[model samples]
Target: MKRSLGTQLRHLIELLDGAVGAAYEEAGLTYRPRYTPVMRALMQNEPATIGHIATAAGITQPAATQTIALMVKQGLVTTEAGVPDGRQKLIRLSPQGRELLPKLQQCWQATAAAAASLEAECALSSTIEAAIEALAARPYGERIRAARAVMVDSGKS
Candidate 1:
């Protein structure tokens, strides 16, 4: 029998990240797998606020903030208050981060190629895309709640 959906998805992430993280370490890069989206956002739009970063990265503002904070600690990025609204933090890549871009870009290209090959072999890219679209239309939480209601009404809960 197959494991739970969430568990399987999480395990997949662990496996993928483990391999990707190893690659980063082998390259002598102090980057984390979780930081890719934020880094890409910053690469394209430097000196951007946390809100903008969050939007570009398709992640929550809090997650962007935490990632930025970690990057700052690692001397990979810097943060300053935004103009007009000093409360907003604007993030920029540090000199060290800038220096690592070429190598990171190479790594990114390799990773992309590997992912494309894996998708071609597995044929799951479309399925995953559709799943994302479906969930966007109706969240998993809503489905779960509806199922639970059915079970309760049927005296099976």
Candidate 2:
């Protein structure tokens, strides 16, 4: 049986992430590759709201919220009520998270170099950027819905 495109894409992501995660382990860092974006966001935009971090990381609000919760649990960050808005919570890295930054920075650079090498080998970055642009113009979900409608109509006919 042939694997779907989504499955293949996820497999590729997992492969790449595993390599990076291994590198982090080698460096004695207990970091998940997925946490990089949120950590970087906190470094550059401390005192940011969940919305800000999500946008800065180009991730969904729920994803950012979940990551933040895990970070808090791991003592990587702390959240408090927003200065002016009691409803909004501001997030920032903890002292431990700040201390981990130096190592994280090294790992980030190494991981970037590794990803660049991979991209050079296959031009994967450009291909992915192009795919994202195409999807922005015409979302996959909309295309799928249209195709399903056509299939249903044809079956009826």
Candidate 3:
């Protein structure tokens, strides 16, 4: 039986994530792949609530909370009470996390360059942005929504 395109796409996503993680490790960084998305979201918008980060990162609230706890333990982020919602906390990168931001940015750039180089060297034929646009133009938002639904169904959210 032939494998479905969804299966192949899933595998490719995993491969890309692993490759990015390896690139960061090669750069002598501890490289927590799970934390990268969280950090990226935070870097894009500081002082965001944990719930906001969870929604933006497409992760469950519990997962986001766990990630934030780990980051706090690692001194990568700090949290304080929110003004509007006293019960909710605002998360921001710690001084150490801020210091590492530039390094992380560099690692991402290196990873992108490495992938581009491999695609060129192997003559792999695929336009990534075009593929993304095509995915985005799907009738029901995108395949990402389907994936997220699976995650939700699995009690992840």
Q: lDDT: which candidate is best?
A: 2
- Residue 82 of model 1: what lDDT? 84
Candidate 1: how large is its RMSD? Answer: 1.5
Q: How would you encode candidate 3's per-residue C-alpha lDDT over 1-157 as one tens digit per residue?
A: 8878789888988998888888778877775777987898898899899999998898999999999999999899999998866898999999998888888989878877877898888644466556756767774455679888998899964
| Tens digit per residue, CA lDDT, model 2, 1-157 | 9999999999999999999899989999887887888999988988999999999999999999999999999898999999765899999999999999999999989888988889889999999999999999999999999999999999999
- Steric clashes per prediction: 0, 0, 0
| Decoy 1 TM-score against native | 0.95
Which ranges in model 2 have alpha carbons more than 4 Å from their true place? none
Stretches of candidate 1 off by over 4 Å are none
Candidate that beats the other on TM-score, 1 or 2, i.e. the better one: 1
Q: Cα lDDT of all candidates, in order?
A: 0.90, 0.92, 0.84
Specify the poorest-scoring 10-residue window by lDDT in model 3.
123-132
| Weakest 10 consecutive residues of candidate 1 by summed lDDT | 148-157
Better-scoring candidate (TM-score), 1 or 3: 1
Would you list the rank order by lDDT, best first? 2, 1, 3
TM-score against native, each model: 0.95, 0.94, 0.63
